[model samples]
Target: MGLIVLRPTRATCVSLACFVVTILCLVSNGPCRAQLSSTFYDKKCSTALGTIQTAVRTAVSSERRMAASLMRVHFHDCFVQGCDASVLLDDTSSSPGEKSAFQNLGSLRGFEVIDSVKSKVEDVCPGVVSCADLLAVVARDASVAVGGPTWTVKLGRRDSMSASQSLAESNLPRATDDLDDLISLFRSKGLNSKEMVALSGSHTIGQAQCITFRPRIYNETNIDDGFASTRRRRCSFTDGDSNLAPLDLVTPNSFDSNYFKNLIQKKGLLTTDQALFNGGSTDDFVTEYSEDRSAFYRDFALAMIKMGDIDPLTGSSGQAQLSSTFYDKTCPRALSTIRADVRRAISREHRMAASLMRLHFHDCFVQGCDASVLLDDTSSSPGEKSAFQNLGSLRGFEVIDSVKSRVQEVCPGVVSCADILAVAARDASVAVGGPTWTVKLGRRDSTSASQSLAESNLPGATDDLNDLISLFRSKGLNSKEMVALSGSHTIGQAQCVTFRQRIYNETNIDAGFARTRKRRCPFNNGDSNLAALDLVTPNSFDNNYFKNLIQKKGLLTTDQVLFNGGSTDGFVTEYSKDRSAFYRDFALAMIKMGDIDPLTGSSGQIRRNCRVAN
Candidate 1:
């Protein structure tokens, strides 16, 4: 007879079945990358990334390196669709990180600096560059603008010719997600549920804005008082609409595993984040990540590589540029050799993408995102990069630095930094063979990336699938992809503010989840504004979240919808039935979501760089 493995059902009922056999095994050997350690990258790419990090450090007063790092984090998040650099852009226009202008600023504010640098580079070099290389350089430079740490970067990438708003919407994850959906999203990107949990560990470093967690604190009254009080001081929710959170709270100024501990308690900032431990087959992995901070870091590095592995430039075909602008837009007849070189470079770019896709699958399946391969001393110090007390360990110019290095080597005086930043993101997504998106070139770079832009571009911590779907739709993503990406929440932490809403407003939610939420998220009578999102399993990464809904214990109304009602019920059930199956679907979906409208032969020139399309 075939063996039958029992799937954990109820968040409370699931015996620590511990299906996750300690995911940290990814780090058992050491740096997972090709022996590339943080030290190595710093030494190799620092020159290119230096300026960006400097800009990041300079951008903020209290936490320079942290701010810089934050920019890098944001950039990484936003690149799959367009390298508008919205990730680095925060809601700086407002202290609360939530303002009308924050979301409305558009692409203009986020990537202005890169444009300026590109224009300057153009004067010195011209068309001899590619956008990908420019992005590498500017990412580092942008980090510097915000007061961030410095790192080394390599260049030699090309640009895309178009941009797609659709892929961004469908591919990105929502703030409120469950284990099943989260796993699905990673699977789409060639990732698995365990890795999803590991990557969620990033919350250990950033801070959730008050707006994002207000729902958890104000709506759900049953919560750890101390946890709610500490976060409540960040904002006010009189209007009943606030969505924000600091990516990290424990070592808010640095990047570390404190977020895992936050999950252990009900202190996570987003309802989606808190869902990790709601009860399910994946919880063991969360425990493992929490137990070993080093393991989390190692995995995180590997996951980053996987994320970066997307669409890369391959051999001889992807003719990389020194900057966004390649030298001589009109090719000379005698330049056949150089043109052939460009063609070969472009082909290489495609090959690189295929390679990245393969790596992504490995990262996703082998051990999830604990991309131990990326770990080699990649850790940064707050003092050297950005201060952790305020900003966290994020840096700037994450990719631009690499682009600049590549462009400068070949063309010298022909590329623009602006295009590099833009193109690199496109190529990166493509490298992972993520969804193909359209990228338009000729974008002028600015000297700054706004905090407001970053806040606006990203989804809020409290957003449900609908809210997330809306955000993604605006970016041109499909409902299917929207549903798929929501799964990222399965692993991350949710701030109390974001989770409070569902717990308190019983009248607003679907009945099934509303009844159980009272127990999981309690709202006090006197101070309805003070509450929390989850009572149990706030940090364990598993599918118990679905089981919670089965029992009406879902903290957020949106979460309950995964099982009890709405279009997501089937998906939730399927995910619960078999974790591996969910992982497969999620990986494919991610690939589609990432490809919004990829450029093809003559769709545009094989960009000399990624930031700018040819």
Candidate 2:
């Protein structure tokens, strides 16, 4: 009944023996794990952890499996190269990536969610947040999302410049691994048998593919007969190899000790899982965890923190900036220069406020907040500025260029054009009587732009309410956020052609409002004519946009559809009555929208000119 060591390599066996000796020495004396601090980012980015938690909670709420997926991402990253974000690297022609390795390709998920978290962190602190640190925080949050223990994740880890497929293939544990091999793998990384048992409890929430456990279910004698039969119903020999079965059938989505309990019952899904309980040295540890959820939670948290501490770059050792004061102390006048230029532009033209806000949205939505929207058309590449949705729709390019010029004069190459856009959009909202929030600094700019991408991403005025919802939902914005962000129409205008069909052909339009619009927008002739989106308070930022929707006076077809017996009607009605609620939610939605994927760290460069790459 005792578990035996499978075919382990000579190197792995020697490494495990060394780790065991090290652990024994540490146990006789005391443990020594350091170099990462929990408060590492407290001053530099106070809201960093909270922001990542919110995103993780939101994503997990939408899909419970996202918790397991995100956890896998952290595990994969740590196993490959000491939690340095090597797994996130994409495969290039010259270098192979870890994402396609044997252990990662079909199993790992949540890269987009990580990218989303990275963007939010960047918006507040910009280049200050490291993708590696972001991954650790996200992993902790994902655990909490699944009703697991919350841990203080030490930060300041930096991203690796390259990934290793070979490392991932060799390091990541397989489902078919034996107990000794699994223990050796964890021990080699400085974790004990108890910690390995607790970490394995994470499988309580996730699922395993049929192919991974088909051998165990059909061929193994250690498995429970009933459990194996139940799994066999869904899995076949040749077909259904890709079918999925929960690791903890008792509560598939809850992060608890149920996985250990299942192993105690001989119902574990994978060979590696059951091997822990097969009269091995780790068997008592597994039994302790199965009987006490608190012990499991505590051990898991410590193990995760230990895993995060492996080979960390630590304070100022890597590309990680320990402080967000980089530009504040280095440039001194960088932010003030951009702010002054933004305020001056908004003072001269009120419409530029809305234009600036739209510019940020356009820039973020296409290729992250890299200021790619500011690039003009060139003979080599027709930039996003002239795309279908941006040709005449987007504005504030001159304002961006002017601000970049002033910032360059004050501190050349210090303030990035991307940061200027993010700051200018925030300043513009405040200039027009909107709620003000602090914008995080340190973003860089992109060298290239995409016209085809812009046309595909930017929503059109003629799009229906469903289209609007789908567009925003694709960017991880829920229905409520979409409604709140659409309120930005209060200070903007729409062209006649954009809404001419609504005025002439749509029945949902208010008769009086349609008649009023038709005066200047007659059928097909005045396609170029303009009309204020929020007629009641065209020059102000308020709840009038939602109120107009309630009255069927919305300028575009997309606007009217929000209130015309649709999913968004309730939000429109709610915003119409409570101005404070509208403002609060609108501000929050803007922050979320501004957090689209962004180029951070050394991925992109700060451009000298807003209109062209440096």
Candidate 3:
């Protein structure tokens, strides 16, 4: 019932999801954080978190603004070097520190607070906890110190050995960044547009120096006149650059969604903040969050979890590791073993190819292809299997199970379930008449799953073109790629309940086609009845889905909306005529989809069983 934001799974760092944007920041070279347990120190150092919490609470008690300052320090530290307390380092005789970096100079504070927490923690358990992990906990507690949502901070991350000033200069988003640049910055770290917009809501409780917003208030065209004039009183172009202004004009000390509401009224404090609502892809979500504070809070918590998960040195001593290769020295036959099993499964049941491909989308869209969708329900807690969007609609779990079994025989515990699903999806596409592209391997499986996330993130059959676009756009997929990916409908079938409304009530449907569909899918109820998504060449992987849409024969309303006189109509028309264009774009789009935030290196575990954790 809530707004479901599609969090893209991380792909192998070969290339980013190529979006047509103003700027593209290449993904940082490092393994991302995963497999972190909230109770990581429950046994080793039980009082570790509580000790830090007490210290943080004491610091914030003296100054309410310290909460916001501490939060910013964590964000800046993570953005530069995986939140290893690198930003807390001071300039020494040997090397320059990140504190002197252009983005952090005279901006970052609250280092003494972290030092105090670390001193107390070291006395209780010396070197048992890492600075990187402690910072994550402090960030969560700081949010709750104000009025923001709370989340469990995953532990066991190690501190970085080195820091990069240049990386901070390139990676950290500027206050004057446009929407595209802001999106690229976060996407490079495996977060999405909705997360970017939600995370920006943190500006609600922070203050910005006049130097950060002077240009926007003085020169930007989209700003509200009265709002800009009021801001200029505290900040002047010639002299008051160091003077401070609240990032959110209304209730600047609160942690609500008022920042988004300010954006709607053209009162956003920074250019990057206003850029979210200025006729861009992130506009609708901004409007949604402005009206619904709970939605904003929910998404903000998710974003913090995601941001905290960026490129932690997991299971290692704070070092960047090489990515997984199909033909690795240790796992020589990994790729071949997966390829053989997937071929056998698809050869046995041809329909399983389409089913497997759809399964990959379902897995990746929810929580980054960690095989969480393949999980069956247990007594402890539910999985994604019973979600409204998944329930009985998703198929091909058996094929992935079979592949994992065979893969285990060849290389026990060497291949991860996350990697298996990626390889299977690629091989499944090849089994059908689809294009062949390289599949990036070496993704680890997640220990937990979320049914609520599955329900919110998955696309619905009744979604309009705008909703469809927004859904894909949340994962950095543009309209062209979305239209091309919808070509998957060319090979699948839908239930009668899914398309019954289109046949009976929709005016754009073809007359004869509607009449034919009405026989099986009636006016009243035949919800479980089945209908092929593409009538012409139903099992073929081609442009027929678009061709059918051109004739108003798309089985679901979401599918037909592609050719229903919208911005995406031209893409549908082009693909319907040119098969090669569709194939090329589809392959690229699949690679991009596969690249959604993945669990790489030692971040996640290699589950022996696809359905349950090892």
| TM agreement with the true structure for every prediction | 0.41, 0.52, 0.62
Steric collisions counted per model: 239, 1, 7
Model 3: per-residue Cα lDDT over 248-348, one tens digit each: 77887778888888999999888988899999999999999999999998998888888877655454321122244654876788778878888888778
Which residue runs does candidate 1 get wrong by more than 4 Å? Answer: 1-62, 65-79, 82-155, 220-223, 240-247, 312-477, 480-599, 602-614
lDDT of residue 583 for candidate 3? 92
lDDT of each candidate versus the true structure: 0.41, 0.74, 0.75
State which candidate, 1 or 3, has the greater lDDT. 3
Worst 10 residues of 2 by lDDT: 21-30
Number of clashes found in candidate 3: 7
Candidate 2 C-alpha lDDT tens digits along 65-137:
8899888888888765466676776777776778888777777788888877777776777656667787788
Q: Give the 10-residue window scoring lowest on summed lDDT in candidate 1.
A: 1-10
> Over 4 Å off in model 3, which ranges?
1-314, 317-349, 408-413, 465-470, 473-478, 563-570, 602-608
Model 2: pairs clashing at backbone N, Cα or C within 3 Å: 124-440
**Per-residue CA lDDT of candidate 1, range 246-325, in tens?**
65555665555666777767676776677776667776777787788667766755554444433322112211112222
